[model samples]
Target: MRRMLIVDDEPLIADGLYTFFAKADIEDMEILKVYSAKQALEWLDTVKVDIVLSDICMPGMDGMQLIQEIVDRWPRCKVILLTGHNEFEYAHQAIRNPCVADYLLKTEGMEKIRETVEQTLKQIARENDFRYQAEWFQEKMPKALPQLQRQLLLDLLKRRGAKAWMNLQEEFDAIRLPFRAELAVLPMLLRIEEWGSYESQSDQRLLCYAAANIAEELLGDKAAVKVAELDSRSLVCYIQPHAGQLQQHGLEQGWERTIRFVMGTLESIQQSCRDCLRLSVSIIAANQAVQWGGLQQSVNRLGLAVFDSPGHGMEKLMRLDITGETAGLSLRQDKLAAAELLLEHMKQRLLEGSDDWMCSFRQWVEITGEGGPDDPFLRLRLLHGIADVSLRTVQEAGLSEEAGREHDLAPMLHFNIHTRWSDIIAFYRETCQWIVLRRRDSCRLDESHILMNIHHYIKQHLDGDLSLTRIAQEVSLNPSYLSRWYKKVTGRGISDYILERRVEKSKELLLGTTLRMQDISGQLGFSDQHYFFRFFKKAVGCTPQEYRDQRKGAAETKM
Candidate 1:
């Protein structure tokens, strides 16, 4: 429905247009008549008008200044100026504004004015649909906020340093993490020691998601846990006990309670994965709760222990035990080789867009950085693997003008795993973020490209076959895929687009050329004139002949 405000200082003209609409065939309109521009503004303050018609010359606020005021206040409202032949000079200035739909000479009849009203309503409908879609997206984005927030927290940790920890503390409330900065946090590292064979990337990803859920679900109540599924089948949980429980016990006792809670949660998680998910997981937790200042080094030790010493079979629970010499150099080399192979497998999983690839990769980098070889030669090999994985993942993500910038690896190339721990972790995280942002952009671009191609194809082939199969072929997409994708992207079906394009083209040809209705119908790919007539009336609220006559009459009146 639409509202039309008719403003004229003259009683006769104002009442006449109001009566004109009251008696007209227009169904969805609230026709209003106001005696003066001031009265129209008063009514506008109370109600929003979709269309405003006012005479150029009034008492205090003339139509020129009145239209300007209405435009600023109700920017969406379309305005039309009515002027006598002498007052037609005002049309020159008023018509310059985008808000001024068109101006009519008072000498022109009211039916001509009603045609303008119908056209404006069509535009308002489009604007309202767009606004509704924008509002809908705003309403839905909050649901994804938790996932995004957790990802941000994990990214912050990868950067390390006091600055990153401080930043994480600041964001705890915003991301709705279930913890406070002052509470004791028990960081638990969960490693999937075995999960049988995995071939498909989708399967690999689903298993990771399943594992993360099992861990979070078991540990969700007393603690605020942020889990990152890192590479090589490890899950890192940043756990903070509820503030109320921590406050009652004081820092020391609360810390002890958190450790016990975390241990119990890990054991439950292991059992759940085995029973419910049918997989084996090893858990390594930080021995003592450390404040944000020493959180990086503390969690690093746990990550290493979880990956290096994943126990055999069901006996997969322990604490950080990496504060010892290696068993033997050759044995360590063999373990590292196995780790490197697992990392390569994870890299493939991520490229496949597996569910928790990013989390898994970060876990791999963090844990492996600890247990990884200290010898410069062996460490260099590990760094190279990390660099290769990072670069390849970034490319798959499509994050930059040139996604495969191996130059980013040049810095890691000169560095090793042991001494440059912080630098490598930071690089890994930065790369992950870059990958995520770019991949999102790529997906959006892909959607936009499909829509643009479909639209262009429809417009260019208005007279040709405009079937879904034809349009899809032109765009090199499957017809069914294109149909759903086009509707999803544009909020309307491909056939709807074709019909709209045909109608718009018919209008242009109707007004611009003296084409016969049959010829025009044929050119628009319509089978016959009657079908075109019904379609034009249904879509435009007027028959094609009525629309053309109105345009012709308006042109002659202007002349």
Candidate 2:
């Protein structure tokens, strides 16, 4: 069943729809009834709602404002606007935004809302299917090389599984070549400029897949491409190892031509919404020899700029100029300039590199933490960014020449230095861990934080008396509120997480010590061993004795 939120200024209208949804066997649906947009936004901050049925005319914040916020922050939530007026002008403007899934007149009755919600949910499920299918294709589809080659690419980008990557490198010695390489990641930003007033979700999904297909074509053995929706207005085609040549002049010419070709192809595929289409390509380059933070950061930086640009077809390559002397205030200005320049500067620093370029790039990465917005993530991304840039820089440079000279520049590029990068990265990660812990300590909310301190308390006191009232009192929340919020946030009731934890504890005692099953059951606060057995079987798919037997048999087999 889909989770839905009904936002209407009128209590009767909200209650009517809520009651209708409940009786329709969609009652299993987690429904949030909000009398105004204010309550909706407040609840939305914590709940993972799937659909919204909101009236257009509410005090303070209207349906339009709610829709805008949903689009901005919760892009995945489908919104069906319930408006009284039938002005085509209003419909035209409201539907212009991609996040407004459907608009219905309040006079259409409760049944219409039910049908609209069902259709919206069905479409969402189908889009999720498409997403999974695309991922499956990414997993199974072969490139010009074998599975080993693809894994080698992943290993190089991630700076992991050195032995396997090395074995592959040795095995594919004919294709192996290294050059002065840096990693560049390109994420396709699909900005819908003017989605027609009656645009369907299927059309949007088609446009996204069409963009992905075009990206795969242009990228052509250069990068691994995948599609995702970054927000309401855009979809992303994440391309890894974003590296090309600055050697031959054709590299620039070819890249520009490729951009045109991709734009044209996307236009052709999404011909229906040609006027609505906009594409922004963002690239981040790092050293190819080490790991950066993660691919997600690069994708985020690239995808975030989609709405900031205009025009239907355009390409912007990130470039950096580091040959300058500055001090104090001048230094701060240059740093700000670099941050503002972002992808452009990094792109230039990658393909056009000197010793000065490397030092400047490294310094930028050290300061910004691989273009990460936060500290821990920043450091992780920096390591990843460095490896990506170095690997792709080496790979592209080598690809320009013959593949035979792979190992020639590997030593000079300090390839050995990256092998030890994991250690330094581990140290950096520890610092990030501290940072994350510190941030969590300061920034987390007390009222609706999903971390479940109450659950922790329950687990600690499970052996003693435990009841809903006692538990609610301990958490300083009403029993009813605790039950609902716990289920909503954790996808299970308090009793459920607690029961599972107790069973887990009991299993440890059963296998690791000589405790009897009855004693273990009692120790876990189960009234009877029989009841515990039933609960264990229901949750674990095995009785306590059967679990112990299976473990013992596995141990024997291992011996």
What's the TM-score of every candidate structure? 0.40, 0.29
Per-residue alpha-carbon lDDT of candidate 1 for residues 448-553, written as tens digits (9 for 90 to 100)? 7877877887888886656454576688886557666777777886667777888899999999999999899889866457767877998899999999999899
Model 2, span 70-132: residue lDDT tens: 876678889899988896876887889776789899888878878898888878888779675
- For candidate 1, give the lDDT: 0.70
lDDT of 2: 0.56
In candidate 1 the C-alpha lDDT for residue 172 amounts to: 69
RMSD for all candidates, in order, please.
17.6, 22.8
Best by TM-score: 1
Among all windows of ten consecutive residues in candidate 1, which has the lowest summed lDDT? Answer: 321-330
The pairs that clash in candidate 1 are 229-359, 229-360, 230-359, 230-360, 230-363, 231-360, 231-361, 231-364
